[model samples]
Target: MGEAYKLDCDICAYTENIFVGFGLLYMRLESIASFVQDAALKRRIEEFIGNPSTRYDAYDALYVCPVCQAIRNELFIEMESDSSQYKISYACPRCASVMQQEHIENNVPVHLSCPACEKGKLKATFYMDWD
Candidate 1:
């Protein structure tokens, strides 16, 4: 895998997960430069295409934030969760509402649903910080 970058929206400060997600989708294509039939366009693709190890520079090539790219690709499915990062930053501003809900069922605490994901909950857990 190449370097992982967290791209934030300039306007909302929301990360453009979809843009990075779709870029990741296309990076799987071998010889991505081959898709363009036009020599001029093909040349341009090669000019800015990053090394396989440090891909994703393209996300910032044309826009300050990738969300402005306005992409709509069906291949944008199958996004991998950046769960490890989320584990550390669960109190993001967007989750403030979800963080306050708690209920007990059958003597077990059932965490409330996350507003952003609509399927997660807040839980306090400990881990050795490796970084």
Candidate 2:
């Protein structure tokens, strides 16, 4: 037997329960720079950090649905009932367009919808999540 390990996410305050044994060695890796020593790992990490899926900073652009011509807000509220779910009900400050949030896999700036126009738009927004 080795030891038990725990991983904590600061943003969500979510902790992952992990058990480590001699058969399956467990290591606590920290920082992107330290994890990837090999060229391939470094490249992969760099690519992952650069990709929007791994990082939200790449998706900071505002989006507008052509069908409705409405500018959607990036700020969204998460549904407390479900940890994996979120909802965007803020009306567009510009066009007063009703906005709804939609989850698309593992990405940021979730999809937005307008009831009046029935347009599914996406934008980069911020939301507060506590666990």
Predicted structure with the largest lDDT when compared to the true one: 2
List RMSD in Å for every model shown.
16.4, 18.6
Query: What residue pairs clash in candidate 2, if any at all?
Result: 74-125, 88-101
| Tens digits of lDDT, candidate 2, 36-127 | 34564445444444333332111111334444545442422222221132222445556666644333322334344432344333332223
Error of 1 at 126 (Å): 42
User: TM-score of predicted model 1?
Assistant: 0.20
How many pairs of residues collide in model 1? Answer: 0
Q: Which lDDT values do the candidates have, in the order given?
A: 0.28, 0.34
lDDT for each residue of candidate 1 in 1-131, tens digit (9 for 90 to 100): 21223333323423322112224325532354555355754454454444343232212111111212221211111112223111101122422321221222222442333233333442322221211
TM-score of each: 0.20, 0.22
Regions more than 4 Å wrong, model 1: 1-25, 28-30, 50-131
